[model samples]
Target: MAEALPRRPPPPTIYRSAAGEAAIRALYDKALAALPYEHAERLVETSFGTAHVLVCGPADAPPGEPDQDAELDPAKHEYGKWALEVLRGLGLVPPANADGGKGTAPPPLHMGTSFGAAVVLDLANVAPEAIRGAALVAPGGLSAVNPWAFALRLMLPAVLYRLLPCSLTAWLSLVSVCDEPAAEELEVVLMGWKHIVRYPPLPGGPSGVFLPDQLSRLTAPTIIICGEHDIWPCKATAAAAAALPDCKTIIIPGAKHFPAKQHLIQAADWILDWFAVKGLVPAATK
Candidate 1:
């Protein structure tokens, strides 16, 4: 008889203790409570694992959109595909190539920030027909980044957590300018640093980088938002916008790598306006 295959180990948990998990949950709940719109939390089973999704907005909304955040790994495209499948299963989106390749359902929109944006682009390259539009914020992998510099900058927070693992250090590490939303984000970061047993290595060696040909394959209308002061991906974003057949680039003034809450709101307005222009959503009333 053939030997049995070894089972893969489970992924690492983010919290060190039950209390830490509870604290993070409390913060999440507080944020959700503050949202003007009602939302529901769902746990959907995917081929890879269970995905926790937060569903907001009206139930009869025209089309479904997925938003990704803070994921850097190139392998994230697999997860994105699974997420799209889940939406199809829920009847929130139409299946790939539905209705004999002439489906009437509106295609889904995708939005992502930083490394998540890279994953969105990967998905667009692989499955252009399924997506109608994309909004990318400070997307990485468009051009070469110094792996050492990027890794060091990303690891600074974790190093601070190791040396003085407190809320203050976490806040100091994240806050360029302090605000209410920044404080809330700090709570989550502090909990994560305090509890995570292992931190994944930052992507390197062309893991997420896309070539010119790959960028040109993204046929869907895309909006790339880059912060003026964002050192990493500004030039790459410009290059990507130039390459994509239907893409627009927006540079936010007085913004850095991670945009502030106000800047995020501005980005959202732009996305909504673009969607309206594309006939994906209704135009805002004056």
Candidate 2:
């Protein structure tokens, strides 16, 4: 018998956006209208605040989740442990006989975009047995950040972000990481996450170093989808593909850094197709 997923919470409210709480509610309505009504949401309490996790799938099928930013959430602050929590949350348990004999159960699968993609890669390297498969979109951490830029983030005061106008900050970030011109809606959302709202500060924040050795440890099948126009060097992504034992890389034409947000349906289709090809979807769905 299949393990039952966590029960759905009463429909308190659905919140999905990078907007400030005041603006998020409004944007949430707009985003929700575009989704099927059957979609449900739950608020996962973390040390920082309540994280809104959206759920959509069959009752019998295993719970598959897309992670939010690992840097911001307490439960997922560490890239390594975050992956294990995601698997356990989805009810995946490591097989008792995993050392040599046939394993007891299949691992959970995960998908992520941008920084979340970095977390996916980190997790795959640290705990491959914890996941069945993984797909990453425009993943970072494959290459080190430019030294000048790395110093800027570390030296710049967090208060400066609070002081800067959201538009300017968002625009600067877009130009730095994205090759394509920013769409108005995308800019607005970026501004919301970067300036309008904030999370508790991280310790020392990220060092922005790309440690290639992490990729060498992955044991599960993986797929990496990178935007041809992304500011990060494509060669770095290629190097990551070369390092992994079971991996494939796809370069999407004309796409940029934030493909999941800018080209939502298109990006999701790629991920779902990979899952189907990998047989990551539950047998019931097949």
Candidate 3:
């Protein structure tokens, strides 16, 4: 008997200008439906304008989900336990941030927008070994075209009022603005979880952090898909497809940076297909 994936709340609406919004939204719906629908809907209110996004999608590795979903059981994916342990190590446990330690971790980024991409990539860079197969539709890496600049353009007026000019330059203001309230709450917890102590790679000396170039260390099976028209992270990410040991690349015709948004069904199918090929997911599962 195939095990069922654990269910969560209804998914929220998603949007992205970096990709074809309608196409991406359709793709997310199809994937969630394939996973059992779980009751997601389109929403009017959004974080970013007109961008297709996926609300409440399968969260970053939930604890014990393996035991709950027999298909995710051991002897199936060796990395299942490892992934959970990393989740635990990263302090993703329930009642997140029990100790009230702020900034000890990255802000609790929800996976529905470009911010999600930045957060996920940062985390992945932290623990690449824990991941096996992955599907990155689009990301807000330095490459992904972000409205952050334009959105900032729109918010300039309200932010400039005589009352709160200092708000823009304060510590962690961007994190607060880009993240949801729940994300802010977790960011508070993160403040407590500082970097693991290590010798500094440079003269500053002994800083507990790693730089972005270290991303090349990850060799897991990864698939980076981009649309023909979407700006940023398209050509480079696709090119990086061959950089990882077990990697593949695809550029969707007439598509843009947002593959899932520009070509939902095709994008979802590609992800499902990639996992099957990697043996992380059983062929029959699809």
Computed on alpha carbons, the lDDT of every model, listed in order, comes to: 0.65, 0.57, 0.40
Off by over 4 Å in 2: 1-21, 24-30, 43-51, 64-77, 94-104, 145-187, 190-206, 259-286
lDDT of 3 by residue, 209-266 (tens): 1233533544666666655555443565555444456666677775543333336677
Instruction: Report the error of model 2 at residue 258, Å.
Output: 3.2
Q: Considering every candidate listed, which one attains the maximal lDDT? A: 1
Each candidate's TM vs. the true structure? 0.77, 0.63, 0.41
Please write out the lDDT profile of model 1 over residues 1-286, one tens digit for every residue.
5233233345556467778777777876788799887777666544445546777778765333343222324454554465565566556566555663455666677787876676566666656666788888887756555455455544675687779877766766565322233666787677677665554422222355677787787788888898875646576668757888888889887677788788889999998888788776789885
Off by over 4 Å in 3: 1-36, 39-86, 89-113, 142-212, 259-262, 284-286
When summed lDDT is taken over every stretch of 10 residues in candidate 2, the lowest stretch is 196-205
Better-scoring candidate (lDDT), 2 or 3:
2
Of the two candidates 2 and 3, the one with more favorable TM-score, higher being better, is 2
Span of 10 residues, lowest total lDDT, candidate 1: 63-72
Candidate 3 worst ten-residue window by lDDT:
196-205
List ranges where model 1 is wrong by over 4 Å: 1-23, 62-76, 100-103, 144-154, 176-181, 199-206
Query: In candidate 2, what are the lDDT values of residues 1-286, reduced to their tens digit?
Result: 6343333233222334334455755665776677764666655432222345667787655554543333443233355554554454444655223353475576666676666666666666557677678777777767654446434432232334456745555455555445554565554545355434344322112544335566666656778888765655556776757777778888877666655454656666667777777777633342
